[model samples]
Target: MKAIFFILFAVIAGITAMAITTEQTTIEPLLTEEITTETITEEPTTFETMPIVGDEYCTWGPSYWCHNKTTAAECDATTYCTNYVWSENTKGL
Candidate 1:
């Protein structure tokens, strides 16, 4: 009788452990992409009027004020270029 009780106790403990261990779970993706295709029509709020200068090509140099309105024929007629072209066109002697 004692041996039978021990065996029944062991089976009940194993069934209780298995019941406590069994759990449902859900897996999810790491990233979720959201698609948007709405045309955003932005109205012009501010106006930046550039002072119109000469329509000639200006020498893009240190002293020349070659801006957007000023063409290539405007400003100084020197062959010197602006200092902004460092990596793009860094020429040497």
Candidate 2:
């Protein structure tokens, strides 16, 4: 019957169209570039001398003592540092 022939022709046309479209389509991975970062930092210094009077040393209160003024300054620059010098408490001579 003419209907059957028309159906068969339509099916073949649709198959051919699909095959052509699939061949024309491309699938490829995206291109990516790698990135890197580097940093240079200086090490902190330490002091070896004993504390002197009238000189301001770094301290966290009545306890911890920092090496020197510079070290105290660095500590104070941070979020967890307070610099102070304790006045010597002595009695008679």
Candidate 3:
């Protein structure tokens, strides 16, 4: 009776070990595929305008000006434009 019980226990343990090994192998392939897919799908970043420049002032073109005089000094330092005509209320030349 003891011999029979020992044989059954050994068989059950062998089967459980085999199942765990198979599951680990299957999951490893899935993880590798996910990492490859993520790397392939990544895209480079892009910008429509220059960074750190004010939106109200024209940073480009021949006729560039800073609309707000309060921040005109900062705008001129950043954009390099001398024309600071309009106040906060006024818009355009």
Candidate 4:
């Protein structure tokens, strides 16, 4: 009947309209390759003798040398490192 024909026409029109408007999507992964190289050798480092500081001297103190002087703030000021003759490291007379 006319109702059946109209129903078929409406379904065909809807399907055609959707096919024209909808989008198709696809995904792909990126490709990569590995590489290798030869190893290189290095020379060993050598240390030089430290120069002795003057009269302040190092001695056998509580920790290192007895020759160190304590600051008023109660901190180790060894960087200046004077008083080599009296330091704990040296063998003396």
Q: lDDT winner among the candidates?
A: 3
Worst 10 residues of 3 by lDDT: 78-87
Model 1 residue 81 lDDT?
Answer: 36
Q: Give the per-residue lDDT of model 1 (tens digit) for 1-93.
A: 999999999999999887666532121231343434542355558988886664433423443443321431354422333434223343221
lDDT of 4 by residue, 1-92 (tens): 99999999999999987776653212112123233343224455788987666434333333444233453113343443343433455423
* Candidate 3: tens digits of C-alpha lDDT, residues 23-80: 9998987777645677778897886876675545645432443534445454454233
Q: List the residue pairs that clash in candidate 3.
A: none
Off by over 4 Å in 4: 23-93
For residues 1-93, write the lDDT of model 2, one tens digit per residue: 999999999999999999888765632222233333432244558878987763653434423333344554455632222323422331110
Per-model TM values vs. the true structure: 0.25, 0.28, 0.34, 0.24
lDDT of each: 0.46, 0.49, 0.60, 0.47
The segments of candidate 1 whose C-alpha lies over 4 angstroms from its true place after superposition are: 24-93
Clashes of each: 8, 0, 0, 12
Q: Candidate 1, after superposition: displacement of residue 31 in Å?
A: 19
Off by over 4 Å in 2: 27-93
Question: Per-residue lDDT for 30 in model 3?
Answer: 75
**Which model, 3 or 4, shows the larger TM-score?**
3
